[model samples]
Target: MIGIDMKLETLVNNGPAVIFLCRAETGWPVETVTANIVRFGYSPEDFISGGLRYADIIYPADLEIAVSKFSAYVEKDYRGKDPDCKVEYGEYKGEAGGHKRNAKGNLGKGRGGYDSFTQQYRFLNKSGNVLWVEAEIKVLEEEEGKACLFQVTVFDISRWKHTEKTMPSALDTENELKRIINSGHVIVFLWRAEPGWPVDFVSENISELGYTPEDFTSGSIFYTDIIHPDDLDNVRAEVSKNTEGGRDYFSKEYRILAKSGEVRYVDERTLIRRNEKGEITCYQGILLDITQRKKAEVAQRLNASRLEALVKLDQMAGASLKEITDFAREEAVRLTGSKLGYLAFMDAYESTLVMHSWSDSAMEECSIEDKQFIYPVKSMGLWGEAVRQRKPIITNDYPAPNLLKKGYPKNHVHLIRHLNIPVFDGKRIVAVAGVGNKEENYDESDVRQLTLLMQGMWQLIQRKQLEEALRTYSGELSRANEELRSVNMMKTEFVEEMRFPERAEYGEIMDYETLYAIDSQQQKAVNTFIHYSEKLRRLVDSLLYQSLEKAGKIDYSFEGMQLKDVLSDAFLNNVFLIGEKALEVEKEVPASLPEIRGDREKLTALFTALVDHAIKFTPQGGKLALEVKEGADNVHIVIADSGKGISKELIPYLFDRLYQVNDSVTRRYQGLESGLYICKNIVDAHKGEIWFESEEGLGNLMHVKLPK
Candidate 1:
């Protein structure tokens, strides 16, 4: 406020200096500039219209050197100083010209007023002219504790270049001192180190501390007179010790009593100025009001303490939910400096407030035989207010009639300062936690700590609940897997029993005609038995293959084989079935067809099963055809029959295991329903497709496409 006037527009436009304020970031994007910027042929609109940047006015060749030198000067090591103190980079005298290379081997302009300093830079103004200008830059505003805006003052120094060789006049020194002192964030003062530290010089901005410069400069009021009595002795002792120890500079934080009778925190940084004889003469220093910083520090310490307590509770990983709740309540009571704390969970189903946990330092003082912490939501007092509002409820004066007309119940503990927070699991309020009767009134910081601890405990409980659910699911899955294994074993044993001895019986029947000289009736019965026995054997094979396919244990021994060979073998083997059914067979397999990559046994079995189905379903004298064609990428085979075709609605589920359109007891198919299902599994194993197009009472065409 000292350097920034309410009439800043008028002051900057009329004064010799051109002032600009901009964001403290790369390129120093200009927010506003005085109209006097037009003197350099750049309108204020040029800077404010987002067309030009403050850094653009800096001579391109020297911008990097200027920024690099300022960066080093501003970041000069001040490790022993207070960490919260802002650094002051006053005018530097050392050489500031050198080529500073960036990663791209080019000059780079460093960003922000964090590295801001005063210096002379060459400016490339409009109209093709170069000018010498002195710039004083200071960070004047902050956002969220970060430097955000910079106030830069640029004055034409071309005229001063001629008289620069001469020493400055007293008036020049005084004016320069005034300008620098008023522009800074700190209030500058020079105090003699004798007789209560009489002030020799005080800047006009001393009014910021509710004191006038005249009052100090007149020597009627000593600097120590404004010091808070509690901090006066310690401050005097620290200064005396530093002076005797020959330490030229020292910083200390203390309190001051303002004229309005308010206490303000301040950080004082002093430089011990000495005479030629090496004897201390006076102290020159700056005083910065740091009340907000001190408050922040205290809050930060409280947060750290709260976080430590929460982390300790979290580390109790195996602790029961009740134990965690108890600990959280106790911690809340301790952290908020409350005499008692309690957590009440909202039992939604019962419409009741259930006291899950509580901690009281004065439990023995209660007169009631048993504590009554649970009540219906409608019957609760102040604790229910948090639930009703779905937010926190806080008050230092607790017994106000408007707030609690019912007051405390019989034998309830005395309540004064109180804070209650609604605990949330997602958007719903799950619980209400409250602390009561702290010696000091509860602040927002206390409320925040209590809320954090409660939320953390609830999260731990939720996580444990999820873990329990996961464990239960895992157990159920293990049982289901065991049951599946038992069923698979039963299927395997059943197929084994059905497969053996039947093959031997069929082999014995193959020689029935040679062994027994029998009549036509006996021979026909023997052949019929052989045909039905063979159908039964194919059914058993289908069941075994279906079970294996479902269990993911079906095996395929694959090789590159000729489809023609597989088809020819299948036809020769199943031609007897056609003869038995009195059906005509027409086979058109290409002689030079592209070989399909598949399991030879499975392919042979697949074609044989299709022909067998045709033999069973077709009436006597019905015709069956097997045709194979070669395509560019795959081999297509069609098995057609002039038999009673399948229903259109049943085609979709034709390959489903054990599925049949006619599932009644009177259904007439001889074998089990897994034949087409097994064929589909075999083709799928070979990465092929099997499907059919059919119409009821019309012929059916089954198509198989296998990759070549």
Candidate 2:
């Protein structure tokens, strides 16, 4: 019996399966495994010593599924048995003890049982390599009626799985190839190397070109019949050159005529099939429809050409109307594949046409003794029909009888085909442009090109005309302005001279006061006269200063001066007004004020004007304040007044020349509206900034900052 057991162990070890016996436990801990486990890069001792369990070798992705199936089998088959019963293996039963199962549940078939089950899953070897395996598990029971062990046999099936994936059936391969071919735009062809390249076989997708494969295969049509006549010679030459050069393949692009009479572009790739004798036998090739791609290319080229022409017209900025029309007419001729062209401008009433320009070709070919430049629209020929009909007119057959045709001059150039379009400015037709003698025929494309070019030309002409008129008007305006300035200068000089006479009268009054003692009424009248004369003199002086400044004739004497000293001079100049107003004035000036580079007289005048303005606006007993501050780069002065402040809406225009808050004749103000304007000019001349802040019914604050 010992010798028989040794032989059985040897037989099992030499087989292709690995056997495992594990205690029925949570982790299914291995108690024994066949020595053949070494085939999976593992030693039997590794499992028997409890270092690795049978569940541990199962791939992580398949472990959950394998354990679930094992539990389900036990629950369904051994449900009524004792929980601690040891179910031991009895005999090798062929698939009757349990159902066959796999990790994917693809093999869940066979009769139900309580002792054994079979499954297939993936296992991880020692080196982490995945192995496809088939496992058969049996429940073993002990003599004490308890399930105590699990007997598992594993067989490697990795080679068989690999074969099933890499090799597919012939029918599947053929069907897949056919599906790809039918789903795309390529048409396959096989042709005999004979005259006209007779078609031997063609793909069913030839229907895309409005033809069937049977048409060519049945010899009812040859491949060469579908190629465009204009492109066939070139295609043949290319193929012949490649074949003579011993080339195996070649590609060519040409136009083909579809059965629906539409021209379609195709790109062909052909392979030459030859016999051992170096003679051509057949040709295998593919044809791809490229009609949309070809049309896009043509449209792109046309757009580029149109843009270039428009740019050229735009660059002729100062050209005359005739030069622009002549160049544009020639471009129309070139763009539309015509031999001669002409442009004519219409009058405002649309009653007459004035011929403006003709292409160089037209001018060179015509030998008419009298070429009319202007013609009445009431008695014109075919070209005038575009203007009369208010639309384009195309005559592809020029000699055909038509009611619009009129007799031409004896020596005029002959015409074959003609296209005419009206150029519209808004809803009115401004011009009519015509092109004639195209080689093929005039169509809508020619009409489009001619219309766009003429429209661009007319715009340039109008722009040049407008520019010329502007130049002439500008010259007249400049002359008028100079004359006005001369008259203004004379008036300013006359006002300046009046100041002398006014001073003489004031002196006369003063002399009489010292010489004689007058009555009280007389004294009062004399005082009133003196006051009115003084105000008149000041008004004259302000007018004179403003005129000189505007004419750019005022000279400034810039020198170093103390800001405080300038302020003191301004206060003294306005002492009388401040006294009359009874205004309380507060001044804050730094003891060590920095000197500033400025015009002293102008700066003093600037401050005097501001002080006088504040006095006029303030009530009889209002308050005024002046503060000077020293800054890092400038000296800032603030002059504030508690007066009836300026309205918010009127503040923006306060400093404008000749602008006043109260300008009506009945208003109380008694001076020209030039005080603040003059003050701003004076400050700006000294490189200083002046701005004001005020709110209605509140007070006003004026800030001045000068560079130190």
Candidate 3:
């Protein structure tokens, strides 16, 4: 068997025929061919290397006729009942009234059960010499019966063609004309000019679209039935307008539904067939599938849009969180072909969602009366599934009944489709981004695009947060440095004052009266030193507490404590400062005040800070009042001082870290500006509210409300 195979191979290789295999496409791109093809003045490399196609070497004039005949034969043979059918074409007239010699042979099934046909056509060699060849072509089809490749065996027939010329008979000419009308890649249709465009005939190749020609010819399906509903009206209008304008032909592009329920884009070129009276009797048209081309165009546009969106996002450096989120949501809606979108950030614990932004369209279309910014994850609907699942959730059919759906709020924007993706920072789902109401189903492509875009936005968000935090830290550090310099200056002044006493002691004691006067002056200096030392101690303590609080290292021991006792302790601690300032103090405490849950040390510190602030800011003889009373559910404390009150603009920043109203070097107040800020923090830690009401020069009134 091996020897026989070798001999057969040798015979074929030395034969005067060139065998070629090609893709069943428009140009019939060559894949492989026998070495003998070089005898035609062309190397096998030319076709195999994709430099030239089989159609490129076909004689220009005969190319169209050859393709038509070949297509007709393949189509007919493929639809035949016999699996091993043989086709024999009789004599046919050449193009443009030319005559050609008859070339005939049996076209049988090839090695793989594929059908083959024999035909003769003119070809051009490398030197442009015209040669006649008998080409036997075989059609290779996939398992699903779609033709994909062609095998061709060409025999030199120039000698026979030059010796004989034969004219086809009338029957042969009629049959050949019919075959020409029914061939080629396009699906040809003949329709009577009626309401539904009733089909009179359709080419057999229409089966490639998963439909039979007989289905239309038998009136089982109308051309209108196949056209997509969205595109049908436009197609009809185009055809009508052209016909009314007396145009012989017109072209249109529209979508059609194949038998498998897939949407296909087709380019239709229609000719208005008319009778002798020029009245439109029927329409002849061909539909060429352009689905792949349309898809490519859509993909290109989508990619360009995504790139543009990313560029815009990159340009949003230092933008506010709202601005960034709004832009990202809008772009997500546009890119996904959606009508609405939203972006929400998850809390650190991932227990709640804080809505960052909603697309402009969604905000306008939604009519819900209550728009809550923060939502507990457990309270959300299907949109929150991304957070719960820690992955992307897609609902192409939003209206379909789903167990996860908790329904929308009243008058909310209607959802047709929805896609939600969780943005992750490591293992944590930091945010949930979503878009909805796309015209088409949301696929993985949309998921991928949205996920990537949101990830980029998240990175920018993190960067902005870090920048804000750094700015705050820098401001705090600058204030701290200033406070340190002030303390150092005070220390130098204290040292200079001590030298006066030292020099006084060096002088001799003159008399009893003089000695007593000196002793009195020294005592005064000691009191002044004590006052400054206390002020310095308070400054250091405030700085230390602030540092610990910022580091999250402050520990509190919560316990039940008497509100009156806490206030008393705070007053006794600052009694000296009150006496130094000579401010009149008043206290109004209800004996029936209830006990409150708080940290005793922190509570004492909170009150002391407030009292100290009042004393330092109050003028001599100013009144200081402290009052504690019981409310329905809280203990209300009021600390009012008849000092120069805070200005309206400065009151807003009273609790901000390191903020000082009188930040000038020559200001009368002496101490770190963190007393009020620390007081606010301590109150907050005990689950209480603190605020102030004051006007310039009207004395400030501070209010503290703590739950009892």
Descending-lDDT candidate ranking? 3, 2, 1
The collision pairs in model 3 are: none
State model 1's lDDT: 0.72
Query: What TM-score does structure 1 among the candidates reach?
Result: 0.33
Give all candidate RMSDs, comma-separated: 26.9, 27.6, 18.6
lDDT of 3 at 97: 16
Best by TM-score: 3
Q: Which 10 consecutive positions of candidate 1 have the poorest summed lDDT?
A: 78-87
* Model 3 misplaced stretches (Cα beyond 4 Å): 1-187, 202-249, 257-262, 493-502, 505-708
Full-model lDDT for every candidate? 0.72, 0.75, 0.76
lDDT of 3 by residue, 1-708 (tens): 999999666655655568998887788889998877877998889999999999998999878876666666654333333222223433223321121222332122221222555767789999999998888776644223334677889977775577354533432676775565456678888989998898999988887779998899999999999999999999899989887755567899999998987788999988787675557999988899899899789878988999988888988986776788888888999888899999887654567888877888999999888888888999888888898888899998789998887877789999888999998764556678899988667888899889989988976765564345345445555555555555556555654555344446444523567456555655555555564555555655766786697699999999988989999999999898788778898999998888899999999989888887777768988899988888899999999999888667556556654332342212212224437767888889888999988877988888999999
lDDT (C-alpha) at residue 393 in model 3: 94
- Candidate 2 lDDT score at position 101: 40
Supply candidate 1's per-residue lDDT for 578. Answer: 77
List, residue by residue over 263-307, the lDDT tens digit for candidate 1.
Answer: 789999888877755578999998998988987986787788898
What does candidate 1 score in Cα RMSD to the true structure? 26.9
- Superposed Cα deviation of residue 611, candidate 1 (Å): 48
